[model samples]
Target: MNEHLKVLCSLTPCFYIKREDQASIIGGVIEFIKELQQFVQSLESKKQRKSLSPSPGPSPRAPFQLSTPQTENPKELGARCNSPFADVEAKLSGSNVILTTISRRIPAQIVKIINVLEKLSFEILHLNITSMEDTVLYSFVIKIGLECQLSVEELALEAQQSFCSDAVYVNDI
Candidate 1:
């Protein structure tokens, strides 16, 4: 099996990706990961619709909103990064950026997240990773390139999109 596929399997013990399903994409494994993420989301939304209410052309309800689960209280410097799916943040100080993410320790999840940083043309000056039983914490200090255009909010969105798994909250789908 491909390395990323192996990683995907590790993250998602429920879904099994067949070797034959490893089709071609422009960016190889990273693009494949994005595709799989979207596929997973699509399935979850369909499942949500089915479960929420049956009489649906489209439910008038608003889409779900998510917030970081952290408390407003202060935490010690090295405290654990805790979040069920992912909590992504980016802070830009001049040309340097501090990026942090807490995500489930599933297969290609980390790779996908790091790719988001690299894709933004940043030099990873410092990277610290901590893995607990089921969650992983990532902290990075990166210097942004001259050509980088994304603001801190955009960076957070990219990282969140990259690693956050939507199906995690659901028991089985």
Candidate 2:
């Protein structure tokens, strides 16, 4: 039984790769982690959605407006790099809580946000920042895991707290 189990494990692709390229196996392991994380997240979201009956809240609409700032207090700082397109949005996909924002104020608000998320242990899946409507917009699609139960309130508060400096103005999405 032990030998059979060992043979089966060796036949698995990731295990084979692990045996072959232990050092460069980091990328494969990272991808495995991501897939596992996503699967767990989907299960969690399904459970959460099932536990509570759907509130008569609005149906999931296109470009669903998840949260917006209560106040718009713009702070001005001198000579920053502006990307000419900035808009931030976040969503809960399966178990992944994706947060994204955009800003045209130079040095790129998205770049600053990436730093903050890194500090907070959030894994970013995809990010797209480009110039639009004469304003720099940042859109981030993140994966929130069990470690980070990123609620809308917490995300909004974090956005307000971290990016509220004179460098980036957290706008309503």
Candidate 3:
């Protein structure tokens, strides 16, 4: 029995059977395989969890921070035009205008801004948008026809007037 156990232990194909006890060999192999399977399953589960999770931190696309004073309500700013804290910039070169805005995240805000631009007869050339938890940033390049009379400053003022939030910042580049 001892010699047989040694032969079984020495078997190259069954390297897992390190013990010399014949009765416990199968049980040990079964236990080892089960442990291996469990470890693999845990690894797979971790991968799946990571893939399914939403971003744990700020998105890479977020461009800037939207900081508002704690004492002021964003909604109040939204009700009025030309917030003192609002920052706006507009650049016009020939018939092209470049505008960028950062503001608190408001639902349908982009649609409203697009509507304003269209009303002013600006043709959208390029648009880029990104959002963090509570803020949104937009960059737009637009072409105004020769017939359109709105200047870059006028357009920037209009956006500030429409958004009515101190958090809104519009700039041209």
Q: How many pairs of residues collide in each model?
A: 3, 21, 4
Off by over 4 Å in 1: 1-84, 165-173
TM-score of 3: 0.45
Q: lDDT per model, in order? A: 0.55, 0.45, 0.53
- For each candidate in turn, give its C-alpha RMSD to the true structure in angstroms: 15.6, 15.8, 25.3
Question: Candidates 1 and 2: which is better by lDDT?
Answer: 1
Clashing pairs in 1: 7-107, 11-106, 11-107
For candidate 3, write residues 50-76 as lDDT tens digits. Answer: 477686632323232223212122332
In lDDT terms, which candidate is top? 1
Which candidate number maximizes TM-score?
1
Which 10-residue window in model 1 sums to the lowest lDDT? 75-84
Per-residue CA lDDT of candidate 1, range 117-142, in tens?
78888778777676656556676778
Could you arrange the candidates by lDDT from highest to lowest? 1, 3, 2
Q: Which residue pairs come into collision in candidate 3?
A: 77-164, 78-164, 89-170, 89-172
Predict model 2's lDDT versus the native: 0.45
